[model samples]
Target: MSKIIDLIKAKEEGSKPFISIEFFPPRTADGVKNLYARMDRMKESINPLFSDVTWGAGGSTAELTLDIAEQLSTTGHVANMHMTCTNLEKGGDPKAAVRGALETAKKNGINNIVALRGDPAAGQEEWKAADGGFTCALDLVEYMTENFGSEFGISVAGYPEGHPNAISEVEDPSSMSEAEKARSSMEGGKVYTCRDADYKKEMDYLKKKIDAGADFIITQMFFDTKVFGTFVKDCKTWGINCPVVPGLMCINAYAGFVKMTGFCKTRVPAELRAKMDSIKDDPDAVKAFGIEFGIQMCQDLTEIGVEVLHFYTLNLEKTTYGILKGLGYEVKGSAWARVGDQVKTANGVGVVKSIESDGSASIEFEGETPTATFKKEEYSKVF
Candidate 1:
């Protein structure tokens, strides 16, 4: 099977835009079954350039993640497995399980991985480093490159606004209770944010990962296009050049949105937050707004020169389909399980801008400055 880096590179040959979707390993057998069916249907309909399966914190869902990844490969979908720096130690060797997982993926014909430092597992407030194991995603990237050479295509996570943990402390001199003042003086009540120095560290560390052989970056989700635009510019200023794919978090429910945004320390635009808060009580209304808002955000990203849009599908399809349909993509094919939509195109390849009533689509080619017309029969939708 082809690696994700190779596919991403393939997307540049013309003007076609691409998209990749991510799914987390489900906890139940039935959930897994449903996800497989959903993924199959999505592959046929949306034709995602590639799809990924997430590893649970501390490798809680390791075996199942591997199984699903293998299944994807067998079914001819290029699977990118997520591997975290947790639960990878045995007899004092930190790389035992990490190496095992990578080797297993290779044996299963999976050459793509998203190296992550992972969040804390269930009931844990902070991520604890495993003794003798890797400390962060940076270490994992370096280790993979050192051990595996060019055998695997690696992509690392980038926090466009800086990581949640990499924050600065602020001092407040406001009126406070005695205990509150004491706490403030100590490990205090000051809120953390990505300030100048912290953001510099984030940039520096990201460069290190790229230098360590990360082929591309997939950013943590952000609502503001300006933030993503600034990040792309700064990556150039920092001399870390590579394809930076935007991660889109599908707005599924009100409560889940609040919880995820709060946990990630993601900055929500005031208007968007208010929009969600207004419809917090009605599930259907909230979902409708999600699809509407998602359509707008995606259009903005595409206009801003974003190529491969990565959707955090959350293993659901309605919102994703709504957003794509709203963006003028002809959502087709069955809702039931099937496979075989793995055509990979190069970057900078012109995407079909318009589909005529008679089936001709406008596509930009290598020499064309303006998009030219092509028959729908002549060109394929690779995204």
Candidate 2:
């Protein structure tokens, strides 16, 4: 089994920043078929250093996730399966599911896993510990170390701006940084946030995870490089020195963007948010912006000498491929079709759609006639 942590540590001379991709198991049989096709296509062109499969909340997708991870590993890709603390029994004739899953992964030649305190199950507002199950991610890390003993390379999640769940609801916002203020959302007009003290405690907890023998950390996605830069600096100051891989969220569809940003309480810069809002009606424009923004964001991170560029691909190809190509990564051309490739855009939030000879696209955000034709660089595929 090829361990991801060992792969990252064993980089040879002149190696470019390591590239890793993430995918989630599909729910339907047809969706799984399509995913396999896409995965094969991605590997052929991008040749990622490794790939990850995500587990559903509360082990809902455990079987499918393990199946994909095993397939990826058996087919010669370093597959890191994600495991959560859900449904795990600590003692008293505990459920064998957790141990069984680990043994199953090992038996399938997959020796890497991302340990997590996964999100609560669907329809649950807050998470409660299961009877006889581990309480948090820390416990899970300890369990793996005790049970496996150097048999797996474990990766843990690090939130650069503290986990959203840990943010303080009653903190004084007056002394908060502008960036900190941006990381909040309004429910009934309360400015809940990740206060400084709370963030420090978070760092302390992160140290415990690393100190518990986690091999590396893959951070939660962030839009601001300063947040990540500060995180890396703080990680060093705290003496928790291990490779921290930035998890990059790929810009996919318009609806998905709003949903994720809102859910994560992610800090989107005013300018970037406004740009996204302006193009909310045009998916192609949003995708084009994603590639452009991803390229610049990646360049900024690379300048900080990050050892790896891990992408949260969200199971799409065009934007990820476009971003990599924009960054001068070797990528073959793909005939991947955009969602609006053949559709009558006459139905959605926009109007007149025209594709030019040079594959440039123009759209009228309101009227029946086009008003502005954006440059090719401003967007990805022509609508």
How close is every model to the real structure, measured as TM-score?
Answer: 0.81, 0.84
Off by over 4 Å in 2: 12-15, 88-95, 169-172, 177-190, 333-383
Superposed model 1: Cα runs more than 4 Å off: 12-16, 89-92, 168-192, 336-383
Write one digit per residue (lDDT tens) for candidate 1, span 208-327: 999999999999988877778878888999998898899999998999898887767776766887798899999988888888888888888887777788999989987887788788
Backbone clashes in model 2, listed as residue pairs? 288-380
lDDT to native, each model: 0.77, 0.79
TM-score of candidate 1 to 2 decimals: 0.81
Give per-residue lDDT, candidate 2, residue 27: 80
Per-residue lDDT, model 1, residue 25, is 88
TM-score, predicted candidate 2 vs. hidden true structure: 0.84
What would the per-residue lDDT of candidate 2 be over residues 82-185, giving only the tens digit for each residue? 99988743344333678998998999999998999898988998876678787888998999999999899999999887798877664566777764675554
